[model samples]
Target: MEYTVVENSGYDREKDVFSHTSYWEAFSYRARHYTDSEIREMHVEIAIDLPDGTRTYEI
Candidate 1:
């Protein structure tokens, strides 16, 4: 399975960023950099590639 993660701050100070990987690296990256409150304020999406199709989730 492959995962693509996107983080959008919707602000000038932080630009939108994305990462594609076969593991949880993308999610982990966000955990390392942003605090819980900061993450809640941002728009975050996680897309997973499965055998049937792609499924996306937003937070």
Candidate 2:
């Protein structure tokens, strides 16, 4: 999975996340187990092709 990473400040100034549907859904579930600082410092973007179109998510 691949996505573009960007900083966002619209909603509480959180880092914006982008990825494929499958990766995003899985990441969402997995993120629940991580601490705030961990997620904040973690990098979750890559460059690759996916079946479905890319998506944007707010952390």
Candidate 3:
């Protein structure tokens, strides 16, 4: 799965702005039983927040 920084990309709730939804949105509502391997097989990348406040992980 690939991620890009596009202008006007997906909504940022913390910023209170409405924007385009990314491909990941399709999987947002899935059950917790869904595994990372399953998601990867589905071409979805998981985003994680690192200890560094300025960093965001996309994998």
Candidate 4:
């Protein structure tokens, strides 16, 4: 999914500067139709300027 910077959040100096970034989100759904044990994995990534350097991981 693409997310445009609504505004500059100064909390993150670097990332806040840039007004846009690329992001990816992945997930698994419909386990009943597929495999429950397989589980669903999601990958979300975005590119932008931020104090933290535009990198985050959430599982």
Against the true structure, whose TM-score is highest?
1
Q: Candidate 3, 46: how far from true, in Å?
A: 3.7
Off by over 4 Å in 4: 1-25, 29-53
Can you give the TM-score per candidate against the true fold?
0.52, 0.28, 0.23, 0.15
Global fold similarity of model 2 (TM-score): 0.28
- True-vs-predicted CA distance for residue 38, candidate 2, Å: 0.3
Cα lDDT tens digits, model 3, 12-54, are: 4322111124535424433243466754544333343343633
User: Which of candidates 2 and 3 is the stronger one according to TM-score?
Assistant: 2
* lDDT (Cα, 0-100) at 57 in candidate 3: 36
**What does candidate 4's lDDT look like per residue over 1-59, in tens digits?**
22323122233342322223343211121222234342222111223334555533321
- Model 4, 29: alpha-carbon shift in Å? 8.7
Q: On a 0 to 100 scale, what is the lDDT of residue 34 in model 3? A: 45
Residue 45 local lDDT, model 2: 31
Off by over 4 Å in 1: 9-16, 49-55
What C-alpha lDDT, on a 0 to 100 scale, does residue 26 get in candidate 2?
A: 48
The lDDT for every candidate, in the order shown, is 0.60, 0.45, 0.34, 0.28
Q: Pick by lDDT: which candidate is best?
A: 1
Per-model clash counts, in order, read 0, 0, 0, 11
lDDT of 1: 0.60
Q: What overall lDDT, based on C-alpha atoms, would model 3 receive against the true structure? A: 0.34
